[model samples]
Target: MEVDLGEPQMLAIGQLADRTGLSVSAIRFYEARGLVTALRNRGGQRRFLRSEIRRLSFILIAQQLGFTLGQIREQLAALPQGRAPTQQDWARISRSFRNSLDERIDGLVRLRDRLDGCIGCGCLSLRKCALYNPDDRLGRLGPGPRLLLGDAPSEPAISPAAAIGSS
Candidate 1:
């Protein structure tokens, strides 16, 4: 259902949970984490704006996409508070989020391409492992598959000819 933004529609905590498909505890947790806000009614009951449904939905989607709570919070911070976000507001945040997702997708593709070969596995078993970290030399570059983690080698670690010959 489309929310009438001009209406002063307030949802009880239970209603908000029902609308967002989130458990009451989960909604409270998100509220505590600053992802959502709740206002106290005259009876001291928590109330949420109808717009919170969209915010909670976005949170769920972002989490599914592997965004951390902090990252999701940063994105949601772009949205207006205490009011329904306008289309332009959502558009701006989505454009920023799309860039992040695109970068992650590119990294995944690069990882897939390298999976057939060494992938900076640090095994040093291959004759010409591009990320040959013999004796853990790349350990100085930090932990876990430095090359695969986007660390650059001082020189071209493997020539195109060598990479082809290895396969």
Candidate 2:
């Protein structure tokens, strides 16, 4: 249950699972997915380096943020081999994920702004609203309230205020 951060220490699978809060099978799954690696003892039981705790923590956090195993693998591949990651390594990985995070944030902000604009309008027509017809470059795309703001015409010069407020 104890991790010696200063030295390269081996942790039994159970210890690793307890520390990481992942089931043994889930830890094995991560290994199979190449998110973690462990050495086998002479008896063929898996033994993990203490560093793996941090790695598994990162994997779990990334998965919570909607990253696929492949994306997590790609990010982990950037770390220096045979050593714990330096702050610079972490910064580099953060930069890699920053763009996607920013895009998601920006999309949410746009949706929030749109929702604020729609509160009084009450258009509720998908065909007319840009929120629903995002593909037309007139509305926003994706599933959700944005797509159901109002049924606007396929090709009309209707202002957003008019579209949502119209009866």
Candidate 3:
């Protein structure tokens, strides 16, 4: 139930939840995390500004895009506290976040292209591993899927048939 109380542009917590499609507890959690703020009514009930709808919506979208809560908080921090975020403020944050999203997309593309090849785990048990990794020399570079992580394979590439014949 929304408690209007004749307030101008202020929404009760439940009203905010309905508008943002978030549970009241979830809104409270965001508040505690400093992502949102609430004003107390005369009955000491939580009231959020109407502008919070957009803010919470942004939070939802950013979280779905793989942003951490801390990163969302930092982005929200760049906006003015007492007013609704302007288009310019959101654009500035988007410019900063775009670089990070681009890098992640590039990494996913790399992983997809190299997934069929040896990951440079240094085991050298697989036929492809013998050709790409060659006695686990990549282990000296570092651990954990070196080739997938953008590390070049130490040995020259060979056809799968040649590798299988050697095995």
Candidate 4:
């Protein structure tokens, strides 16, 4: 059903949950996390604008895209609060994710390209498998999956074995 914002449709909490396919508790959690908000009726029941369906949908889709709740909340928080977000507002907010999404896609592509080789070569035994890790080294590159992240090894991995033989 189309929400007529001009008509100012208000949905009860349960109705919002039913429409969004989220449990009532999950909706409350989102509210607590500052991802969405709800008002209280005269009887103290939770009430949500019908437009909240779209807001909750964005949260679900952003999570599916691998964004954490913090990230999603931050993006959504950029919009005007206490009101339904306009399409332009949503478009601008979603655009912020584009760069990170591209990076994720690139990482996935690299992983897919190397997966067969990593599995088939059986290089883990060598401990020096080119596909596994040519050098167990720590580079100037900060923390994280270094090789998988496409960083060249800046320095050889320092190990007690290397130190014992060197001395």
Candidate 5:
């Protein structure tokens, strides 16, 4: 985002790929998706603004953080194309991700914490796990890994000794 008018104002597609470490096809894909734009020179060759490097960098980070391309495109559209984004602009854009980021983190945490517990599906074949679920009780919540779907276990798993005399 540093404005160095000293460098060329526009760069060729190959130069953009080199500077951004993206393949030519990837850069072209981004353009097709409207995440970046290219202009045609007199020879009909594609040229891109130097600022597109920063834009591509943002796209890379957003994808790494599990954002869908559509979501990244929406966020990038908020940035003004006439100039480089100021720090304040970035802050505002970051704020927009806060709720979504928190939700994503929460889901990951839930999966991490609950994945070991029996989901009442008996998939693990652990007959006496403390979190053992019986009779597909977790299925009452719905299909598709109900425990992972946020359904709580019906009870703490019964101890094996306690289960032995009960039939």
Candidate 6:
């Protein structure tokens, strides 16, 4: 039951499950998917290297970032067994995820800017706003904002002169 920390040790399935906070079934699933590999005992039970703990942790973190199992596998493929991941390997993976995170942040910023513009414009109806009618040709387009908001139609446009001095 005592693990020797001085040497490279192999752990049983139960111990690995406990150490990784993963169910035995889930560990087996990872093994089957080639995300983690284990050696077979003479009795055919699986034995995992202690390093698998770190690998499993990485897998969980990658999954949280919305990477598919296949994508994680592809990223991890660059790492070899019996050696820690090199700086180059880490950089490559980091670059891939960084690009994805940057894209998500850009989209959120764009959405926030659009919402801020709507607030400043005092336009409750998205369909009838000037921001929605970028080209000012919604009438010819037949029922909808053609350029900006591009959602649904609003009330018909009234002439500016008619409403200028009216109470």
**By lDDT, who's the top model here?**
3
Query: CA lDDT, every prediction?
Result: 0.82, 0.73, 0.84, 0.73, 0.78, 0.68
Candidate 5 lDDT at 99 equals: 90
Candidate 1 lDDT over 29-112, as tens digits, reads 999999999999899999998889999999998898799999999999999898888899999998999989998887888788
Please count the clashing residue pairs in each candidate, in the order shown. Answer: 0, 14, 0, 1, 0, 0
Candidate 5: pairs in clash: none
Query: Lowest summed lDDT over 10 consecutive residues: which window, candidate 6?
Result: 144-153
Return the number of clashes found in candidate 3: 0
- Which portions of model 5 miss their true places by more than 4 Å? 1-8, 113-124, 127-132, 154-167
TM-score of 6: 0.59
TM-score of each candidate?
0.73, 0.67, 0.77, 0.72, 0.71, 0.59
The Cα RMSD in angstroms, rounded to one decimal, for candidate 6 relative to the true structure is 8.4
Please state the error at residue 73 of candidate 5 in Å.
Answer: 1.4
RMSD in Å for model 5: 4.4
Q: Candidate 6: which stretches are off by over 4 Å? A: 1-6, 82-92, 108-167
Q: Order the candidate numbers by TM-score, best to worst.
A: 3, 1, 4, 5, 2, 6
Q: After aligning candidate 1 to the native by TM-score, how far in Å is the CA of 36 from where it should be? A: 0.7
- Model 5 gets an lDDT of 0.78
Residue lDDT tens for model 3, 1-167: 96554644889999999988999999999999999999898999988888899889989988997889999998889888866677898899889888988878878888888777677887676777877887788888988888877888655667767867865
- Which runs in model 2 stand beyond 4 Å of their true positions? 1-6, 112-167
Best-performing candidate as measured by TM-score: 3
Give the range where candidate 1 is weakest over 10 consecutive residues by summed lDDT.
127-136
